[model samples]
Target: MGQAGETPGRPDEAGLGARLVALGGLELGEFDAVPSGPAGASAPAGAPVVRTGEARKRGRRRTHLISAGVAVAVLGFFGTAAYLFVDVGGRSPSAAPPPPRKSYPAVSAPVAVGPQPVDQGVRTEDDLHLVCQNWYHPSAPRFRGDSPHPILISEDGGAEVDYRSTRTLNQAAFAGSSAQRRAWAPEPRRAQLVACLDLTGPGRPIRDCTSGSKVLPLVEGKYRLTVYEVSSHRKVVDRALTGADRACPFVILSSVGDTLFSAVKDRQLYDLLRERVEG
Candidate 1:
């Protein structure tokens, strides 16, 4: 009953589809394209669709791979920074540090020698001049006759030296003797001599020398004594003297001579004498 080339229900169907579209429904063509269940059975409306297992697995793998790459990049940056910090700023292993400084006790002033003239009986060489003298007495009775007489001597107007007389002589006789009498003659069997340079300054002389325990026959020869600086306990002088020097004076008086003579080359004796003299 339709006209040629016209669909029988086409116009009516188009109008109904337009009316549905205006009501916010799907287009008729789109609605028909939605798949139905098995054998084209219609599914229940408004149901949520779940994703497949393979799709979920693929998504998780991509996320994990991206996280691993980020972690690696961050670790590499930190490692490079740490390496630069040590290489540019640190000290070398072979470099040595400075040594520590040493300290010492303060030194006292030099001792002043005598204004009195040395005894004329005391023998002297033309090259030497006597400056000062000191003596130490012996503590033990057996050593009473043996005393130390430290005589300060100047050579060629240079620094002072200590010439110690190791002898037992009568002080009164030696002091009172005239030039011709020769009363101050030292006993050859009981006399010897030793010399050392005075390291202590004026008024602070440190006498150091060495001698035999018992008197030996006086053989004219050179004897050496090592003198030490009292403050630092360091050796300052090593000197020698001859027994034949006539100007080298004998210690006066047996007891006084003994008191003045003990400290030479003897540490205990030196300490005792220092205590008594200083105290």
Candidate 2:
């Protein structure tokens, strides 16, 4: 049977062409029927192609999804890079400490000037002249007795200031010798001491240990010299000659003694005894 409303028989070939021409209003021999092959027949020409709405919508959705996926990939790539950078170098830098200030010393007080009268120590060697120019302090205020006291010199211990042979000792040792106070001095008492000083102190039993010094130091454990008025048994010079004085020169001691030792008592005892001996 025919698929359409035709009789179930092979159509006459010449008539078939004419029938299709009449139906389709085409020329009679425009289409010649070819024999059917094992490959089978194709669809008739000029068929209308219709598509479903769901299929079109599905295609559009797939395009939009692909575009969105690409955008998400770009965003995720930048996001991952930024996250890694922040994780690796997220901490802030620490600040450093400052340096210390510069340093220096403080200023000192000013120096003193003028003559220091207070007995500082012994005189120096530079001022050991024939006459002392800087006799800052004299043992006594002034000389008394209107008559000059010629010194009656005597000594117990000391290498210097000898009374035995001053003329020979001066020429031998102390001739041109330059020392502030020579431990071996042989100065002339009358010539050296042009004046006298009162060196009397609180009477104490003193030991004149004036050994091997230029001046007869009033130290303990040495010589003993006692002067008295011959006419009377009165002791005129009973005081010790342990020279520990810190006063100015007695004109004679300034020439012999220095900052360490002094002969003020030596000169004082000489004058006190000289008055009794000569008079």
Candidate 3:
């Protein structure tokens, strides 16, 4: 029973199909009383209706995917941040300030100095000439001979020699004792009998020079000595040729290595010295 404008409440033709529909708990002959017009919306023909449980299941799956994505993004952000912090912490303290740039002193060539000797424990003559040791310090009156000669020392303070009498004969070869040589080592090479230092030119002086020879003199007495500052053959040449006439024939050069000549206990230079004596 259906009206002209009314939909069916249930199908009139019923059979096994209706019984199967009933078993599924669905009323197959019944119609939903929904208004179908242009104003009211309805499902289009041949469209499937989704159940509330299936829609809920799809919504749950989408929510789970979104949550997993958020978790992965959060983990990536924290991991990157942690790596940066670790890298910064592992670095050394700002590279040690570049090692303080070495600063060196700027210098050119070395300077050249003249010939000079160090002044330590050096002695000087009465005239202020440099001497190496005392005449009577340890070894006095060094005399080398076949037999030891009784050392005859002068009565004066410094052993002065007479040039005129000492040079009359040849007595330059006789070397003194070891003790006497050591005592006279500080003073320049001098003659016990010779007098006067002749400075004539700029080469080696033609003095009575001796190295390894011996000579015998007829007479032995106190004689005038001429002391000269000698270093090498060249210096000896320069010294003998460059200075003015000295005050005494028996003279000694200044120990400062200067080209100056001076006199010691001379009868002319010192009024106190009547006669200079030497051993």
Question: What lDDT would candidate 1 get against the real structure?
Answer: 0.34
**Highest-lDDT candidate:** 2
Task: Please provide, for model 2 over 10-74, each residue's C-alpha lDDT reduced to its tens digit, 9 standing for 90 to 100.
Answer: 45644754554454422322333332221133436763332234543454466567768999999
Per-candidate TM-score against the hidden true structure: 0.23, 0.19, 0.24
Where in model 2 is the C-alpha error above 4 Å? 1-51, 91-279
Which should have the higher TM-score, number 1 or number 2?
A: 1
Give the alpha carbon lDDT tens digit for every residue of 114-221 in model 3.
434433322323211221111221112222333212211122222232211111111211355454432322241221211233222132222331223522111112
Error of 2 at 158 (Å): 30
Error of 2 at 196 (Å): 38
Q: What overall lDDT, based on C-alpha atoms, would model 3 receive against the true structure?
A: 0.31
Candidate 2 local Cα displacement, residue 264, angstroms: 22
**Model 2 weakest 10-residue run by lDDT:** 125-134
- Worst lDDT window (10 residues) for model 3? 232-241
Error of 2 at 152 (Å): 42
lDDT measured at residue 169 in model 3 versus the true structure, 0 to 100: 12
